[model samples]
Each structure stands twice: as C-alpha cells, then as structure tokens.
Target: MIDSHIHADTRPYEDFEMMAISGIEKAITCAHDPLPMKSAVVTLEHISRLQKLDVKRAQENGIDLYVAAGIHPRAIPTDYEKVINKLPSILNNPKVVAIGEIGLEKGSKEELKIFKEQIKLADKLKVPVIIHTPRKNKEKVIDTILSLLSENLDESLAVIDHIDDKVVDKVVDRECMLGLTIQPGKLTIDKAITILEEYGVDKFMLNSDMSSAPSDPLSVPKTVHKMRLKDFNDSEIAKVSYKNAEKFFKL
Candidate 1:
C-alpha cells in the first residue's frame, strides 16, 4: 500500500518500521508548515531534510519513500519567491514526486499568491500536485481551492487532499484524485469506506497525513484490512490503497 500523504520528517523512524510491518510498501512525504518558518533558508533546510534524511530513514525501515517539496501556505516566508525560484532544481531530484501539501490555510491574499505560484510551477514541470485543505471553513476553502484549480491547473494533475464528507462532493467530479486522510480529528475509517462505496474507488486514495498531530502511520493498511472485512473486492481495494497514487505520481 502507498500512503498517499504524510509528514515523515515529523514522524519517528520507528513509525516507518511500524508502517512497513503493517504492509505499507511505499509512502509520499509532503512539505508542510514547520511552524515559525522564519526565512526561505529555514524552509529550504526543511525541504532538504525531507529529500535527504527522511528518505533514507524510510528506506532503512523497508519503505520506498517519495517526496513532494513546496512552500506550504502556513509556512510562507517573506522571501517565498526565493524558494519558488529554487524549486525547479530541488524538484529535479529523482525521488521527488510532486509539488505538494500546498494550498489555502487562512486563505489570505498572500496564501493564495504562494499557492498559485507553486501550482504554476507544478503545471510547468508537468508533475502532479498534492493540494491541502484546512479544517476551518473547510467548505469555503475547498471551493476556493477548486476555483483556483479549475482556473489555473489541469485538474488531472492535482489531488485535493484531506477530503471529508462535507467537501467530498465538491471534488468528486473535478477530474482529479481525492485524498481521504485517516487520522484523529479527521475522517475515520468507517467514513472513508462509505466515501469509497458511494464514489467508487477510481479517483480516490487513502493516506494518514501523519505528523505531530494525533495520527496512525498504519492507517492505510488498517483501512485495507477493514475494506476486506467489509467485502470490498480486491480490485476496489487495490485502486484506493495504491494504484491511484501510483498512477497519479507516476511512481
């Protein structure tokens, strides 16, 4: 199984071991807001760690890890353009899969600007993107994200992540993939299954979005177990558990 989204840099090495043991064969670690992102230099260092240190850690623990580097909205620095300028070179790394975990947080002008810039970069590079939607005003934020995506990005090249029932309908027919983040304070396993049943598994993927927040690295495998018990066919299970992500990220 491929956990479509997570912050492996913030997780312990042991978590990767647990993930491997639980049947996660691969995972994608996305760039996120490391609070108090003071400068472009700090953000660059964070991206470096995701590409270098975290990738090695996951490999050592028996997981094939890929990376998505970008300026997260909450981590937007004053000199964010500097980071954008350097992303082309950084994304050239073979293990880098997408430009992601990037999108509206507070939905400020500055946030939208940075989000658009990264989307443009991803589109220009012809790479997939992992888009984030915030918890507060989720519907509004998702609508804004959808609008931006419709106007600026090829919907097929983006995955609108952290989708719950509230906004799932909005993204379902957008010609993009949807990420159901199974974690505490997020979509529970049962809800995820329901979404899959209703929407079909073709354009959806499962992820933990694990970070410092209460999370489970074993989420994807656990969901797979539950899906099997619920009598979902192997093809349906495979689509959400791994195939969608593999095809989207070209992994």
Candidate 2:
C-alpha cells in the first residue's frame, strides 16, 4: 500500500520499518514547515532532506519513498521567489512526485499569493498537487481553494487533502481526488469508512499525514484491515489503499 501523504523527515527512523511491517510497501513524504520560515534556503533544505535523507532512510527500512516538493502554505518565506525559481529542477528528481502540501492556512492575501504561484508552477510542469485545508474555518478555506482549483488547475491533477465529513460533500462532485488522513484530530477509521461508503471508493485514497504530532504510521494498512472486516470488496479496498494513489502519483 502507498501511504499517500506523510512527513518522514520529522519521524523517527524506526517508523519506516514499522510501516513496512504493517504492509505499507511505498509512501509519499511531503515537505512540511516545522517552524516559522526565515528564508527560501530553509525550504530548499527541507525538500532536500526529503529527497536525499528521508528517501534513503525509508528505502533502508524496506519501504520505497517518494517525495512531493513544494513550499507549504504556512512555510512560505520572504524570498519565496527564490524557491519557486528552483522548483522545476528540484522536482526533476525521479523520487519527486507532486508539488504539494500547499494551500491556505489563515487565508491571508500572502498565503493565497503563494498558493497561486505554486498552483501555477504545478500546472506549468504538468505534475500533480497535494493541497492542504486548514483546521480552523475549513469550510471557508476549502471554498477558496476550490475556486482557485477550478480556475487554474486540471481537476485530474489536484488532490484536496485532509478532508472530513463537514467538507466532503463540497468536494465530492469535483473531478479531483480526495485524501482522508487518519491522524489525531483528523478522521477516525470508522469515520473514514463512512465517507468511503457514502462517496464510493473511486476518488478517495488513504493517508496517515504522519509527522511530529501523534499519528499512526500504520494508518493505511490498519484502515485496510478494518475494511476487510466490514462488507467492503477487494476491488473497493484496493482503490483506496493502493491503486488510487498509484494511478494518481504515477508511482
């Protein structure tokens, strides 16, 4: 299975082994802003860590690691243009899959500006994107993101992530895919199954969003087990746990 979204850079090295043991064969580690950004260099350094260190670490532990490199909305720095200029080359790394973990936080003009720039960059490069929706005012923030996606992005290449029931209906009809992150403060397994049943499995994928916060590295596999216990079919389970991510990320 592919853990569709994670931050292996912030996790201990052992978590990779545990995830592999839990049946995760591949994972996508996205760029995260752990602290306030000082410069574009810091963002580049973070992406480099995912590209080199995290990939090596995950591989050593028996999981194939892919990267999504971009400036996360909360991590956009003053010289963000510098990072933007370097992104095409950074994304050229074979391990990099999407331009991601980018979207609205406070919905500030600056945040929107950075978000738009990255969206355009992804579009220009013909790569996929992983968009983030904030914890507070998610309704408002998702609406704004949907507006930008409709105007600037190919629905097939966009992933609106960290969805809950509150906002799932808003995104279901769109052609873009959805991400259900099974992390603390996100959807529980029961809730995720509810969404899957309601929305069907065609466009939904499982993710852990694993990072410094309390998270289960085995979330995707655990959710797969839960699905098996229920009435879900093998085809349905495969779509959410593996095939959807494989087709979406082209990994």
Candidate 3:
C-alpha cells in the first residue's frame, strides 16, 4: 500500500518499520518547515537538511519514500521570497515528487501570496502538488485554490489533503485530486468508508497525516481492512488505498 501523505520527518526509524509492517510499501513525506512567529530567523537551507535526512532515513529503513517540499501555511513568514527561492535546488533532489503541504491555514493575505507562488513554482517545475487546506474553513480554502490555479495548471496534478465532510463534495470535482486523512481525530474509519462509498473512489487517496502527535501510522492499512469488511471489493479498495496515490504521485 502507498500512504499518500505523511509527516515521516517527524518520526523515527521505528516508525518506518511500523509503516512497513502495516503494509505501507511507499509514502509521500513532507519537508519540515519552521513556523512564522516561532522561527523567523530560521532559513530554508537549515530546514532543508531535515528533508534530506528524512529521505535517507526512510531508505535506510527500507521504505519507498518520496519527498514534498514547500513552506506550509503555519510555517510561512511575512517575507518568504528567500525561502521560496531556495526551492529549485531542493526540488532537484531525486526523491522530491511534489511542492507542497502548501495552502492557507490562517487565510491571511501574505499566506495566500506565498501559496500562489509555490503553486506556480510547482507548475514551472512540472511536478505535482500536495495542498494543506485549513481544517475549519476548508470550503473557503477549496474556493481559494480553484481561483488561484491558473489556466495552465493541471488540476489532475494536485491533491488537497486533510479534507473534512463539509467540503468533501465541493473538492471531489474534476479540478484536482481529493485526499482523506485517516488521523484519529480528523477522519475516523467510519467517515473514510462512508466517503469512499459515496464518492466511489474516482480521484481519491488516503493518508495517515501522522505527525509528532498521538496519531496512528497504521490508519490507512487498517482502513483498508475495514473497507473489505464493509464489502468494498478489491479494485474499489485499491483505488483509494494505493492505486490513486500511485498514479497521483506518478510512482
């Protein structure tokens, strides 16, 4: 199975072992970003090392891990141009697949500007994207994404992660990929099953969204089990659990 999204950088080698044991053969991991107020002095080059180490650690642990690089919402500063400028070199890394976990969390003007810049950067690099919409005003976030994506932007090359029930329908259109986070609090097993049952797993993917918090890395694999129990057939389960992500990440 492939975990479409995860913060594997925040975890240890044992965590990769756990993911492998849970049947997660591959995963897309995000680079660590220093928050705005928290670390305004931190440079992108400093944080980029963490991303390199993440890929190396995953390989050492025998997991097929891909990296996504971006300044996440909570990590964006008032002036992020210097950070964004460093993306081209970071993106040159072979394992880097997408530019993301980028989107509005606070929905501020500066945040939107940075988000737009990264979207364009991803397009210029000809790579896919992984977006992180705010947990509360997700519908607003989706609308913002639709408006910002230029005519040349390939909607099929992006996935909006950490989506909730309220914005599910609005995000499931042909515009972009839809991601379901299997974290304990955000999206439970039952909610995921229901979303797949209703959405029919067309442009959908599942992620653990597991962070340093008390989240489950096995959530996606466990959800696959529950899906079978609920009578979802093999192809249907594979579409959401692995195939969709495999194609989305172009693995």
What would the TM-scores of all predictions be? 0.98, 0.98, 0.91
Q: Order of all candidates by lDDT, from best down to worst? A: 2, 1, 3
Number of the candidate with higher lDDT, 1 or 3: 1
Superposed model 2: Cα runs more than 4 Å off: none
- Writing each residue's lDDT as its tens digit, candidate 1 over 59-172 gives 999999999999898898889999999989988899998998899998999999999988988888888999999988999998888888888888899999999998888888
lDDT of each: 0.91, 0.92, 0.79
lDDT of 2 by residue, 14-111 (tens): 99999999989999999879867789888888888889999999999999999998889889889999998998998888899999889999899999
Q: Count clashing pairs, candidate 3.
A: 0
Counted clashes in each candidate structure = 0, 0, 0
**CA error at residue 234 for candidate 2, angstroms:** 0.7
lDDT of 3 by residue, 1-251 (tens): 99888887667689888888778899988754533434434646434655677777877777888878778877765557877887888777778778887878868887888788888888888889898877676787778777777444677778888877888877777668888998866899899888888878887899898888678888999999999999999999889988988887888
Model 3, stretches more than 4 Å misplaced? 32-47, 150-152
Positional deviation of residue 83's Cα in model 1 after best superposition, in angstroms: 0.6
Where does candidate 1 stray beyond 4 Å? none
> If both were scored by lDDT, which would come out higher, candidate 2 or candidate 3?
2
